[model samples]
Target: MDLHEPVTPFAVLDADKVATNVARLRGRLAGTGVPLRLHVKTAKSVEVALMAFDGTPGPIAVSTLAEAEAFAAAGFTDIVYAVGIAPDKLTRVADLRERGVDLVVLLDSVAQASAAAKAAVPALIEIDSDGHRAGLAPDDPAVLEIAGILPEVRGVLTHAGRSYYAYTPEEKHRVAADEVAHAVRVAERLRAAGYAAPVVSIGSTPSGHTPVELTGVTEARIGNFVFLDLVMAGLGVCAVEDLALSVVATVIGHQRDKGWILTDGGWMATSQDRSTAQQKIDQGYGLVTDLDGVPYPDLLMSAASQEHGVLSVRPGSAAELPDLPVGARVRILPNHACATAAQHDRYHVIGTGSRTVRAVWPRVRGW
Candidate 1:
């Protein structure tokens, strides 16, 4: 099928770009001796995960039990449910473990640890590396307190969530190093207290790409790297040309006097994520590109309705809006790949520098 055969507002993925992105990270970590526990929370597709792991199942981290269950059914044996485990979800985790899937859970509180311990599930302590979200501090007394409650302490995990704001390579490296140091410090603390806590995992797309010493880290969890978006591009973590995921939309109308080109793709299609707003150059909703994946100069999806995207030249730019007519096709590069991809059920796969659809990969949804 051709890339345009799919109806407007569908997701598209470049298989070659995905492979290159995977290789780039693998190459960066080649000497670090730490394996990548590929995070499926972004792509949420077994095919993408297999591609990240070079067509074989290896260790993976998931944000939901649905992802863990789906991957377990797909022959992924070693898995980590990286989200804070709810006591209610312990039964499902135990069920997966009974099926020979080493499904590890993550938690930061004694309450969660108690549930995990009673469920007999191996767990990782979540450390607050940058205070971007959940997790105990590296030196928090609760680290040992949680370790004392859990029977099987797998290790510690931290994400440099704030690393997304790192604008320069040096800043990204510093954040990545700090992320690793925090996780390793917590792991060392666990080990010193007589727990075998061996897994020291840390990652974010920025940290994963930045070359950092992984002396004591056991694994890195990366997901958004599989589909670099405008956010990553804005952060200097990747180039705009490296973005592999896009929304294929057809022009629905044009407001020539106002210099707005409307498309069938909107917030529902591209998602409501505005992560690039914090960056130096704010991509309102997304960047506009041609169907072949070449970006238009100064064009952006400036506004969107539920099913309509307004494309216009960037404010203050002298560039003219391209003469896109009704029914014309265009591709929209997303602000956040994970959020945009979540709005679609599957990907229309194309090769690098090509428009022909080679395959369609399905994405798993639900909690």
Candidate 2:
């Protein structure tokens, strides 16, 4: 049996396209006077992380300690864990730092800062730009308080998560501007308090991809650009053709009567991230395409269960599955690249049906 025809569903990433995405993102950030701290959560693989930092100096952002450890092991020293670090994980951060790894963690609360200050690990103040998750307000008094108390605090970080809701270029640019304003406010507050808040980090693929005015932001951390998904396409961050990663699954059953194509790869393979569908166009689960990554004219994987994906067909497409056999392989672009990437342990690299066993990027599970 051919290796590419293996039983298990595989996640494939195109090296060539990923390089192009990285180059495009770098070009967009040019003349913005800010360094790009590429996020590693989207591409869990160290190989992909290297590709992200290719030709550029280190300085990458990660979401998990495991990613920090993995990248640190691979000789990447500068890593800012974007997620809020719990009080208990301080030891791990210290350990990585003790080993010469510049592992900068995020602190949102005074208590977290107090705990972090005792650990001797460098840290950043997670300032809220769009309030997608945990972080202090840009002008919140706690920003200065935490900056003062946490002597290890190095800088401030902000994510304009609202860009995910953006539909037009203007909306994305506005979110980017908001992020820059917020980060600048917090950084200035920290500086006024005698803290050397050097790094004013801002992010969001949509906002970063647009013509963002990063006059004050010292760095930007973005991830999804490495593997633009359906969500990025829907938000106009990138075209569908720019999507570099996809889930390759075999068609198991045909719903000729109901017009559904069942696949082994389902919600378990893709994720339950419906953030993209909230836009004008509901992409359902994702855009379903053929083996060559071409979306079928009228077919989309609208719904999915734990182990099965249901395909929604157009009004008159009974002849669409004429050549689709029981075991034909298909590619599925995920709704959210970050969430879907966290669901897999390995990425199966494929090229023209010839498969090469690369490396299984073990994910960091749990909170």
- Candidate 1 per-residue C-alpha lDDT over 27-119 given as tens digits, one digit per residue, 9 for 90 to 100: 887878888889999999999999988788989999899999999999999998988999999999999999999999999999999999999
> Which segments of candidate 2 are over 4 A away from where they belong?
1-3, 55-57, 314-323, 351-367
Model 1 deviation from native, Cα RMSD in Å: 0.9
Off by over 4 Å in 1: none
Question: For this target, which candidate reaches the highest lDDT against the unseen true structure?
Answer: 1
What is the per-residue lDDT of model 2 for residues 221-321, given as tens digits with 9 covering 90 to 100? Answer: 98889889888888888898888787878879888887678888888888888866687667777888777667887677778899898776644557364
Alpha-carbon error at 240 in model 1, in Å?
0.5
TM-score of every prediction relative to native: 0.98, 0.92
| Candidate 1 residue pairs in backbone clash | none
lDDT of 2 at 117: 83
